[model samples]
Target chain A: MMKTSKIPILKLYNNLLISIQWELDDKTAMQFQEDLLKKIHETGATGVVIDLTSVDVIDSFIAKILGDCVNMSKLMGATVVLTGIQPAVAITLIELGIELEDIHTALDLEKGLELLKELED
Target chain B: MSLKISGIVEFIRMHRDEIMKDWIDRFNKADAQSISAESDQIDQAIAAEYVNILIEWSKNKEDEFSRKIHEFSKRIVQLDWPMDKIAQCLHTFEKILFAKLLEKQIPGDPLELLSEIEKVTSPVNREVFLQYTSSYERTINLQKMALQELSAPLIPVFDSITVMPLIGTIDTDRAKRIMENLLKGVVKYRSEVVLIDITGVPVVDTMVAHHIIQAAEAVRLVGAKSLLVGIRPEIAQTIVNLGIDLSQITTKNTLQKGIEAALEMTNRKIVSMGERR
Candidate 1:
């Protein structure tokens, strides 16, 4: 059996914070998607902030999975905010033709939380 | 073969003064403006040095001949002598030297003398042109580097707001540079809003519009909003005429309005002190 490491999801107030600290493989990404949705469902969090400050090298498949995760969280009534995306990663994603439109983005975790608060109002 | 080579070398040495005088006269007639622009003494000195180098090279000072030719070409190029002027100088010298060779009887066949003269003169001509073009290419490369350095500069005008004023036409290479610099500046400055002022840009065709839209989209992905500013009246007309969908991006007619909107987006505005007083 291959050990699949799960991305930890922390709950704070009515929002869930996830910081991807390493490069995610396909299996790990899929697991993270399922785990995040489960956490959103269990906690009934109204906002989610996914921080990719430490993570690098997101391929097209990983980008698609992230987009799917954002949409899935939205379907469950949680607003998703992506934070701390590196410049290289942003350029790569743009070059790959994945705009990730309609997704909220912030400079850092503090800004991401502030954006979520603004949306709540 | 050795005797023939020495004979041609001896002939040039014997008539060296005559050759120098004739070359200078013909060169002055051919390029009078350039010659008179400088002092007559400097032109005479250069021509004298050129004839001396040819005489030395024919006498079998191969290494010194090449080094002197290299330095001579570099000096003339720096002096901004036109390539045609240099060619004309070489042609006049060759004609004078061959005429001297033909006028005086030598031990070798006429064809052999012609070929030997060709061997000596052709290399110098080729070397001069080679140096000229290489220097020209070097200048072009330097200017290109300078232009690239000046291409995309991102300035942080206010807190959390940056401005990138683009001048000149935006080609694919420059567009790619603009996008990279804009995105990198946003992250580095932690800007919430960016204003791209294209007032200096003369033309906005469909391709340029597409690049702008892509840059705006990339900025959005990087967590900053991009506002296209400095749209001239004609640019606005062309944008609509081309059917470019700039509706998705916020654009202002001038940079001043763009800055105001940027400040407003960042939840701050400049209030006049006179009104408060």
Candidate 2:
């Protein structure tokens, strides 16, 4: 049996916050995607902020999953904001040719919430 | 053969002063302007050192000969002596030595005597040339480092606004550096907008434009907006003519205008105060 740990997602008011504190393997990233959508459904959240401050290396597959999660959450009526992307990761993603063009981004969780609030208004 | 070789060395040692005079006179005549600015005493001292190293080599003092040659070459390099002039100086000394040996009619084959003279002089020539090129390479490497340091600099001008002024041709290496600095500066300064000023860039070909676009995209990914500023008229013409799409990035004609736009994005403005009464 393969051991897989679930990334914790916290709910604050109508917003769901997920801070990835470690490197995410493909399995965990997919599991987080599903869990996030289900949590948004259960809590009826209108916004999501995914903080990737602690996550260092991201391959193309993980980037694609993150982009997909954003689009999927948008279809379910909750806006998603990716926050705290490291400079190295950003350069890597750009080099990998993944722009994540439609996804909203913020510098940190605080700004991510502000962006979410601005989107709501 | 051994006696003949020692005889040639003995012959060179016996007429050392004559060889020195002839070598110095020939060197000064060949490139008078190169050494004219320097005091004649320093020039004579360097020439004497050269002759002494050659004498030591002919005497079979290999250790002292190498040490003296190394120090002499370094000094010559520091004095900014041209390599060709040094080569000519060594050639003149060899010629003078051969002439003196032939005039005395030393008991040896002319070819053997000439080859012996060449053996003593050629090593010094090679060492000096090696030192000259290595010193030049050191200087070029230092200047390259200095240029890299000046290539990318991010200045945080106002709250939530930073400025990176690029001042040279954007090669792929420099472009990579600019992108890294722009992103790190944005995150460190918590800047919402960054203005990349390229006023000093001389040319903007397709490759440069592509690098700039990639940098701007990476900045966006790091959650900061990048504004391309300082677009001179020619750069604008090239950018448009190349059919590069810079529509995604906000651009301004000057850094001043870009700063204003950055202020607005951060929900601020510069209000001018009237003159004091």
Candidate 3:
């Protein structure tokens, strides 16, 4: 069995920044979800920006988990902002007919933070 | 030996005018029934130059004759003459000249001289035919490029809002172009909302809907919202009948409503002034 490293969720100015730089296998994605929730609870952050700039492929299962994470975070009173979704990934998700309607998306990390700020305001 | 050929060449050259007049008369009579007015003018103007080139086709003037034929072929293509007519005219010129030489009894072997004449005019046919096909290929390529340019056009209508009005039938290749142009326009225009007006689109099938959905998602990914406008009653029915889910993306019945929605998204609105007070 190959070992998996945990996806780190960094804390920056009361918001969590998770820039996924590698492909997420099923196990790593689930682990990342759990760790993110734990970190959100520990820091009590109200906004989370998950950047998928480097992620190219996203299957339905991974997409479902990501959607669930947004809902879960919202339940905890934190607004989640998905940022830096590449063109190819957007096309793939659309082709798969997986529209994360409940989720808010931004062009990049900068815009994501601004969107979060706007929502807070 | 060469002097006899030159003498014969001079003899043929002396009767050039009579040969040209008869040939043109015959050629024009044969084609007058079918020739258009514009083409008749071109044929009249080009006949003199064509006769000159044919008359000068001999050992000393072979190079000049070839060059003239090249120019004549280019002109014929520009005039839009049929390929068969060009070859026929050249053969007619040869037959007329050969007959004239025999009637005049020029001092040379008629068979040998006929073979010599063949050498000159054969290139004329080959060159004209080559030029004809190349010109056709060029025209086709130019038209294809023009069609591609007219295919997809993204126009910015307002501040932070752009509209891409689509018309005609949608195919996969055109859809791909639409997607690329949408994403590029979104970033370039810094548009917060994009209204895709499909009033001119005739029919929308599952494939077209899928493409539009994909384009909308791509627009969303680029940080702009896409609002589909101009969904006719029949199109709506087709969507429902096909069981296609378009609920995720906001849609409107007309471009006006879509623009209004876009304005609202960008926190703006058009206010109608009461009157000049």
lDDT of 1 by residue, B80-177 (tens): 77788778878888788888887875556778787787776776778889999999999999999999999999999999999999999999999999
lDDT of 2 by residue, B147-197 (tens): 989989999999899999989789999999999999999999999999999
Q: Give the CAPRI class of candidate 1.
A: medium
> How does model 3 fare in lDDT?
0.84
**Order by DockQ, highest first:** 2, 1, 3
Q: RMSD, each candidate, Å?
A: 2.5, 2.4, 6.0
Give lDDT tens digits, candidate 3, residues B188-246.
77777999988888988999998998898888866778999999999999999999999
**Recovered fraction of real interface contacts per model:** 0.63, 0.80, 0.37
Task: List the candidate numbers ranked by lDDT, top first.
Answer: 1, 2, 3
Candidate 3, clashing residue pairs? none
Report lDDT (Cα) of residue B188, candidate 2.
98
TM-score of chain B of 3: 0.72
> Sorted by TM-score, highest first, which candidate order results?
2, 1, 3
DockQ values of all predictions: 0.70, 0.84, 0.37
DockQ of 3: 0.37
> In candidate 2, how many Å is residue B266 off?
0.9
